[model samples]
Target chain A: MDFSSKLLEQAVDEVSQLPGIGKRTALRLVLHLLKQPESQTVQLSEALLNLRKNIKLCENCFNISDTQLCEICANTSRNSEIVCVVEDIRDVMAIENTNQYRGLYHVLGGKISPMDGIGPSQLTIKPLIDKVQAGKVEELIFALSSTLEGDTTNFYIFKQIERLEVKTSTIARGISVGDELEYADEITLGRSITNRIPFENSLKN
Target chain B: MDFSSKLLEQAVDEVSQLPGIGKRTALRLVLHLLKQPESQTVQLSEALLNLRKNIKLCENCFNISDTQLCEICANTSRNSEIVCVVEDIRDVMAIENTNQYRGLYHVLGGKISPMDGIGPSQLTIKPLIDKVQAGKVEELIFALSSTLEGDTTNFYIFKQIERLEVKTSTIARGISVGDELEYADEITLGRSITNRIPFENSLKN
Candidate 1:
């Protein structure tokens, strides 16, 4: 109906743009922030501004990173030879939370979705193949979703790696469908990782 | 487990500090923001930063305003003498949404809460009494909560306005609880306004 100030209206508009937030909820939040100490709102603004400015994608895995390389890629104790391929950084976090995988990661950014015009070239496949071609990587684990695009991306990776003679596998898809690897429970995800199936052997006839 | 960058971590921490957000939800939101274009994020940051800097408290009614006097107080058609005293600006918005009330508002900022150490002196009661004593005001509406603090604040306001000989009333408690006026559905809040009871009459019995 009526707003007190342009700034209040602006703030509510911005907050409502966020995922899952509507106009009413945004207004409530803006009012809540108004009641808190000024420093709290200042910190939140600083944090949001800094998040985009300071964060960069890791050169190695394309995951979020403070340095040139992500923490997982830089750690010497991690298994560099067994690389886990994921669709995005969120997947890396989900898998890391399981505490079972000690391997390095390769973020594809996204799967091959022709509808979205995202093909293999749009992904980090060239670097992935290069990493595999370097001769140190013993096994490559496919942890992409079980969607059609994910399946197509998986098939492309499997075909490319077949020429190298390296062990290749895909995380089990019996418990998953569509593009929801980002929100799967830890137990189901952990189980999928543990029960990975050999793509080459499964397809051999 | 592992974060992409320190800025991302800091952003997540700041987002989680909001009223109902937690760490996981904060991460999800941060990732969502990250996926958005830089222009969108910049707009959000600008909105948040300008919230306090651009908005001012209306001098006349204590409602938020971009100018010295709020629109409601400046309106010639509105009944300035029939001030609707409310807890905050949200109540003002609620009333304005109905398109029924044409009276000005008096924002108390908050009610008297002894446990939180808030007292009558901390509220806008002094100015309200002054307005009533100025002899222009004919009726004062108490739109505070139904909670103990709201009742106490109402009693304190009633005493202050008693000597002014101006009629005083409170919105019906049947519609809302203390601090919950912000969430009352429009119909209920409007009904409470229409069914207001005289504070002086209630005290007489």
Candidate 2:
């Protein structure tokens, strides 16, 4: 699309570089900003720049943080022995919202996706392995998604620390709490039946 | 959702301020930016700032431009006597893309919408009237949308220049090109039949 102003064109181009946003959408967004007060644009730009310039990763778990350590890793009351391994901070926020998990997290940054040129080395697998080897964690929970990439990342890390004394387990996969049995997928239904928990144990939750 | 970092939260908040972007989508976009090279964020922020600070409106037509006069207005080859009045710069671009009209444009910034607290005074209507009163334009074409606000704005402008010797016309309302007659809405289909053009006139385009 032809732009009358180079500044508008540049702004639209940069906005379209974001994931999921196309050229038309970028133009619409930029035009929206142009219509708003200049203070809105200034605040948005400053917030993005400040975030990029000063955001830090937790020294312990590699989660995004303002300080050297993330809140989860720094909390003393939380269980340090049981560490949940996941894809990124979004998962951390998801689990945290549940108010159920009290253990710390080890953010893998991303899963092992060879199709995307992301191997085990590209993730935070080494730091997690080192943490497990140091005998700080007693149990390591694999809370990654059930996709092929998630399994590959989980298996790769499991192989590295299989000889250690750490207890390893994956999150349970089954029909969601409110979902009906008729709507459940075949593989999930089969697994749910095969790995059915004891009746008394289901009541415990 | 809780963010691990305050910077991340701030960025997400600002991004969600945009139309159609919610908190979850904002977080996803912000996280995507975090994964990318820092330079990407810097460039996006800088581009927005530059556009907001340096972008100008065309002095003649009030279209968004980098200079005092837009490209169309600066070109002497185009017909200055015939002006198509539009709601905003996007309409100007759309009309330019058609390549059918060789006349210049007069961008009204926005239509008069009292529901949105937008009055004619808030738009560039006064300058447009002043231009018409100066005898610079021989014909004024109302190319605004067919919405209520568009009609109100058009009528208001027409009343202001009713005593002038200039000719006033509105863009034809009809079924879109390549659209089937069966699928056309009642109003558009009815209007198309009532205002049907001669076969030879239609063939001319």
Candidate 3:
């Protein structure tokens, strides 16, 4: 698209470089910023710049934080012995919102996706293995998604710590609570049936 | 969603302020930026800030520009006597992309929408009228969208210049060039039938 101003064009070009935004959407967003108060743009730019410049990763969990350690890692009340291993901070937020898990998290940053050139070394797997080997963790729960890369990463990490004393487990795979049985995928349904628990155990949650 | 870091939270909040972006998409975008090189964020932030701080509006046509006068308004080859009235710069860009019209443009910034508390006085309607009154324009074409607000704005401007010698017209409304007749909306089809152009005239384009 032909833009009247170079500044406008540059801004739209930069915004469209984002993962999902296209050129037209970027133009619309930039135009919106133009129509708004100048302070809005200033605050947005400052917030993004400050975040990129000053943001930190938790020393223990590798989750994003503003200080040396993240809030969850810094908290003394949460159980640090049991770490839920997952891909990125979004998973951490999702599990935290459930309010059921009391254990801390170890953010893997990403899965072992060879197609994307991301191997086990690109993730935080070594630090996690070090934690387990140091005897700081009692139980390690693999909370990654059920994709092939997720399973590969999980298996890779499990193999490294299998000889150690730490107990290893994975999050359960099952049909959603309110979903119909007929709609569940075959593998999930079969696993849910095979791993069935007592009726009293279901009522406990 | 709960964000672990205040810096990350503020960045997400600011980004979500853009139109059509929600908190979840905002978080995803922020995380994506965090994963990319720091220079990427710096360039994006600087581009936005520079655009908002230094952008200019063309004095003649009110289109966005980096100079006092826009490129189209500055061009001597374009027909200044024939001015196409549009709602915003997007319309100008769309028309420019067509490469069919040689006339200049007069951007009204927005249409007359009372529901949104926008009136003719809030737009660039006065400057447009002044241009016509100064005997600089021979023909004025209304190219705003075929909406209630657009029609109101067109009629309002037509009334102001009706007594003058300048001729006034509106862009044609019809089924799109490649659209199927069966799928065309009733109102557009009816208007297309009512305002059908001469068979010979249609062949000229």
Judging by DockQ against the true structure, name the best candidate.
3
True contacts kept of each: 0.81, 0.93, 0.95
Model 3 lDDT, residue B6, Cα? 94
Question: For residues A1-205, what per-residue lDDT tens digits would candidate 3 score against the true structure?
Answer: 8888999999999999999999999999998998889999999999999999998999999999988988899999999999999999999999999999988999999999999999988899999999999999999999999999999999999999999999999999999989999889999999999999899989987
Binned by DockQ into CAPRI classes (incorrect, acceptable, medium, high), candidate 3 is: high
Location of the lowest summed lDDT over 10 successive residues in candidate 2 chain A:
A196-205
Q: Model 3 residue A38 lDDT?
A: 99
For residues A62-140, write the lDDT of model 2, one tens digit per residue: 9999989888899999999999999998899899988989999999999999999999888999999999999999999
> For residues B90-115, could you state the per-residue lDDT of candidate 1 as single tens digits?
88999888776888999998999999
Deviation of model 3 at A57, angstroms: 0.9
Question: Which CAPRI quality tier does the interface of model 2 achieve?
Answer: high
How well does model 1 score by local distance difference test? 0.85
Which tens-of-lDDT digit does each residue in B108-196 have in candidate 3?
98999999999989899999999999999999999999889999999999999999989998999999999999999999999999999
Taking all chains together, each candidate's TM-score versus the true structure is 0.79, 0.97, 0.97
- Candidate 2 lands at a TM-score of 0.97
Query: DockQ for each candidate?
Result: 0.58, 0.89, 0.90
Question: Candidate 3's chain A scores what TM-score?
Answer: 0.96
Q: Give the per-residue Cα lDDT of candidate 2 at B204.
A: 79
